[model samples]
Target: MATCCFLSSSILRHPSHTTPLQGRLQTRRNFSFFKITAIFWGPKKTTTPTTRSMMDVSLGTFTLIGSPEQKPPVEPKELQQVSISVVSSISNVSSIDWDACAVDANGQGIFNPFLSHAFLSCLEESGCAVQETGWLPQHIIAQDENKNTIGVVPLYLKSHSYGEYVFDHSWADAYYRFGYQYYPKLQSCVPFTPVTGQRILVRDAWYKDQVIDMLISALKDLALKLQVSSLHVTFPTETECQRMKKDGFLQRTGMQYHWKNRNYKNFDDFLMDIKQSKRKNIRQERKKISAQNLTMKRLRGYEIKDKHWDSFYRFYRNTTDSKWGQRYLTRDFFHNMGSKMGDNVLLIVAEEDDKLIAGALNLIGGDTLFGRLWGCLPQAYYPSLHFEACYYQAIEAAIELNLSKVEAGAQGEHKVQRGYMPVATYSCHYIVDEQFRNIISDFLVHETKQMEVVMKMMQDSGPFKDGLE
Candidate 1:
């Protein structure tokens, strides 16, 4: 019989010790499924080989509270009623409700329908994200009583972590030392995106925990059943981390810099927020570019035509060719994005002597704007052209659009001095091998603590008069 269970809190009066395998669940709403497996964490023994195979894919409930300034604690809880079903493809799910979970509180962030059926369909249709590309989409969606989506996680059964920003090369090396395989790991993340948003999209705070617990459990079980190396959830919220921690997932911390709008009224207000030295240097950079008879223009939505993509792709090709062995996005992909995503896209191009010298492409979200790709012609000698095309133009547009933040992409201490604040990102891990898991867990504890300390120190060293205050 298919059953549904409702849990309001974490007051676990009856939990199993050892490993929880198959358990009976009480439900309010009737849900249909081909198979049913539930695990509640407590102090009872219920471990079996078959049970282990199924239970490995389940997770219990937990919580994460507070902000970067103050660390909070998580109270332990058990999952009430969870239904786990595996689909053969992402096409089975609707992208509309699945993507709705990504809508931020602000109305100005990018609502990329890429995770949608049409987009994922395009990837599968275009052969962009497939076995050949090492990206196998294995999306997971959880629904409640009315069959409305409660949560959806865009997952990939990745053979390599090339596009993922979170580096696990060190962990892989350590595993190899002990004679283990780390390839063919399960990844729950947005493909080729390091921008911070809801990786696991759920409704309210209560349903959020429930849906997250469900995903964690399913991934673990899939790892064991498929005999894969590990399960990774990248760039999740700190609140998501608390639930993951309670479910026994290893946590890792990463850093990315984002510029926030501080009632900046305009561009000059933003420049004044940075340190004086940085402010002067930026002014000089802007001035130098202005002196070169270069004109910069921002084209959004339908304003960008097919010919624009041709020039932009050429610039993109030049940028990638300059790198020793950099991977390049196909020309078709860029054209497709601009075509499919209108108004949501922005192209900042620099023109000099009636020729396109540099360009940067950004995906504009509701409250946030993301800098994704950039390129420049070698002959264009506009000073600080890269910064202007990528950063300055983005800041100006974000302000003009009244966006709350502009994420400048990854890795830069330099970005800190440029008025971008440091923010900590998170990833959750589950290693199959016990020995390796323990070693990694120890590493995480130390790593997380160090990250906390560094975040505070960076806050203290922030340039703005009222920055950390």
Candidate 2:
């Protein structure tokens, strides 16, 4: 039976063994309006505690009291009536409802294509993210009083962490050395994607905070019930990372290269903002593409034909095979995305003698262009072809579309010289074992410091002109 739970006058509780809170929640109601007063710490722990409040008339009998910095009160075992059911696939949930929580998570009209139903469904429908591939979808769905879907977390019960860009192989090896099994872990992330966005997908309602709190609690409870070694929410937004930290999830920081647009009129306008040497080098590299009789084409929406997807998949497989990387996505995934997402899908193809030799795949967001995959013909090599198709083309497309930035995937310092700057990406982890948690936490502290220093160095070495930083 489906349960319809309400957050009416109920206390939001963290897991029993989670962190402690040093603040209180107060809710006041006047006729139709409900006012919530939340007194908690800010994102930085060293900052002074503060009180923040808001009033919303639409919320009925629910108010949230905790912020990302404050620990939510642990719900008593008796009040754990909120039911969470894990679906084997994302297709079980209707696209309309899932997208409602995804795109409008904050009511600020922010849209992330990576978290949409169409994208996730494509992974499953195409057999890319399934049990056979080690990414068995166990998505957590939460409903409200009226049986309305308020929150949905894209979770996977994984036997390995091949597709997740956040490396956890060391942790697995540690467990194995100690005679502990760590294969079946819970992961909350987009399969093979490392883009930073909201992991805890919740509707943008007045009771959004309460729903998020419930969702976090549910995730921990589910993790324990399944007896997995840990629960991981990777590539979450920085704000989401902080919120999960309050729920006993250890925060992890990573860095990705992103190109931010500054309202350039054209590609030439952008090149002028970078250093002279970088500008000259980029021009030279781009020249290589044309010099080799290669033609670049940007296809979007219906402009991307069936043959385009077929060629792109071959290119994709070629790149993965050559690098000895796992081919996590299937050919059907591209067709599904193109058919469903339409204009949001951007395919940059490099043609030689009218034959598609290479391609770069990207998804358009509300304000950002996400560069996800790139590959070329295994039989041939074109000097600077990868850079042109992936980085340069993405920047040009973002500028033309008036998008804010382009996230060119993960772990590429090479992108730094091509005008992509380093930006911090976040993730949160909940380890079941106390000993492992402590060890990972200490390691994270050092890793974070190192990452900060490296990011600074990358910023200094960025291609931007002097004073741009």
Q: Pick the candidate with the highest TM-score.
A: 2
Question: lDDT (0-100) at residue 390 of candidate 1?
Answer: 83
| Regions of candidate 2 where Cα sits further than 4 Å from its true position | 1-83
On residues 1-469, what C-alpha lDDT tens digit does candidate 2 reach at each position? 2221111111323323222211111111211212122121212211111111111111122334444444554444412233455677788889999999998774677789989999999999999998888887888887654567778899888888788878777677656544557778889999889988899888876557777887888788777767778999999988889989998999988778899899998899999998899999999999999999999999999999999999999988998898946788888888999999999999999999999999999999999999998988888889999999999999999999999999987666789899898888888999987766876786576566656766776788789988885
Question: Candidate 1 regions off by >4 Å?
Answer: 1-83, 104-126, 143-149, 203-208, 378-381, 449-461, 466-469
Compared with the true structure, model 1 gives a TM-score of: 0.76
Error of 2 at 164 (Å): 0.2
What clash pairs does model 2 have? 13-73, 13-74, 13-75, 14-73, 14-74
The local lDDT score (0 to 100) that residue 434 gets in candidate 2 is 72
| RMSD after CA superposition, every candidate | 15.0, 15.3
Q: After superposition, how far is residue 451 of candidate 1 from its true place, in Å?
A: 3.6
lDDT of 1 by residue, 136-249 (tens): 776666665356666667777777777778877766655544445667777877666676655665655444554566667766777777667788888777877657877778
Candidate 2: 10-residue stretch with minimal lDDT = 49-58
CA lDDT, candidate 2, residue 229: 83
lDDT of 1: 0.65
Best by lDDT: 2
